[model samples]
Target: HTSYVLGCAFSPNGRRIITADLDNKARVWGAETGECQLIIGEHTHDVKCCCFSHDSKYILTSSWDHTARIWKATDGTLMNTLRHEAGVDSCAFSSNDKLIVTACHDKIVRIWDTERGQLKHTLAGHQHSVRSSSFSADGNRVISASYDRTARIWDANTGDM
Candidate 1:
């Protein structure tokens, strides 16, 4: 009841809820009882968004720290760190779970290889900050929305402009 919740996401199974907070923490709770099950707290800045991986085995968070992190949902272990030029606004995994896309305040979108934890490509064009991004239904492309008053489609595999 005292938690400063900022973003909330339901697990794929709907039994658990994950919340990201301005307090620089993320917590997992029971949806029915509001009982906290786990806490993730490695972020150095306020967490803006969080989500459970498709399999529910991992938690992904984007923050003002200019990075997005992936954690083991079961134990809160840090698994990966995805960096950006400016604050990270949001992130999402491809439908296949093999790639991740992050929208950043630097006005660019970046794709990462989930398994290797390496930056795959940067899609640049927006004149202002990129606010959000999502994978196409086929996972072959990404759509990015920006504060620049424009939206863009990018080749997910190549990061083409």
Candidate 2:
């Protein structure tokens, strides 16, 4: 990365690492060798957050480009793009890896179907940018924290608080 790294995480298996940078790029690296394995430079703006799926088969990245993307961890194949009305601040996969949750600068939190790459629900209520979001351990709920000094929990499928 030619710019500052905004986020970095180790894969579940501990064999690989992923980093998001201000240069609009996310790279996967071999943990043991410290070698770059894959570079996903698809975002139009700075990449803000990056993480690997619990199974270590996928990578998720959030960006200021107004989108969050899912990728094949090993080969960097773009699997899906989760678009938002504003820059995405954070993203995470459900424990089962079947769903996704995204927090956006648009002041909304959204739930998405990971495999289909489609929107499942839009959680609206935050008065300020939603800074982060995550799925419950069982994947039945989503919790989002915002710049508004509030955090909300919603039913993952219904978008009901």
Candidate 3:
């Protein structure tokens, strides 16, 4: 974990916790005893955001290193590393946890296949840095909010804005 903790999220069952820190790491913690569980130190810069998959089986994090990463929630094992042109500001897990959406300072929103670790779609329409992105309840769509004073909806499958 970094020197300054940036963001944190709790598992769906509330048994564990994950934190993103300026130390360029995300850490898994035992919620009950506040004991440090696992340390993910792959990011080369500050970690901006971190989140858990809906089912609490995975952890996702975005960082100033211009990347987002996924890890196994139970053991902190890295599953994937997603690269972007600019710092990754935020990320979201699809309803089924099979996909991820990453919003970055490059003003692009990228969708990814979790299992295969492949790029799915690049939803590029924002005129400024995208602050955050999310998968819709049904997981058929994605929404992004940007510093350009716009919130856009997109077709997750086709990358249509």
Clashes of each: 0, 0, 1
TM-score of 3: 0.94
Worst 10 residues of 1 by lDDT: 1-10
Candidates 2 and 3, the one with greater TM-score: 2
| lDDT leaderboard ranking | 2, 3, 1
Greater-lDDT candidate between 1 and 3: 3
lDDT of 3 by residue, 60-116 (tens): 999989999888987878888988999999998999998999999999999999888
Please state every model's RMSD to the true fold in angstroms.
1.4, 1.0, 1.3
Model 2 steric clash pairs:
none
Q: Order the candidates by TM-score, highest first.
A: 2, 3, 1
lDDT against the true structure, each candidate: 0.88, 0.93, 0.91
Where does candidate 1 stray beyond 4 Å?
1-4
lDDT of 2: 0.93
**Candidate 3, pairs of clashing residues:** 2-23
> Taking the tens digit of each residue's C-alpha lDDT, what string does model 2 give over 1-161?
79999999999889998999999999989999999999999899999999999888899999999999999987888998888899999999899999989999999999999889999999999999999999999999999999999999999979999
> What's model 3's overall lDDT?
0.91
User: How many residue pairs of model 2 clash at the backbone?
Assistant: 0
TM-score of each: 0.94, 0.96, 0.94
The 10 consecutive residues of candidate 2 with the worst lDDT sum are 73-82
Per-residue CA lDDT of candidate 1, range 123-158, in tens? 989999998998997899999999989999998978
RMSD of 1: 1.4
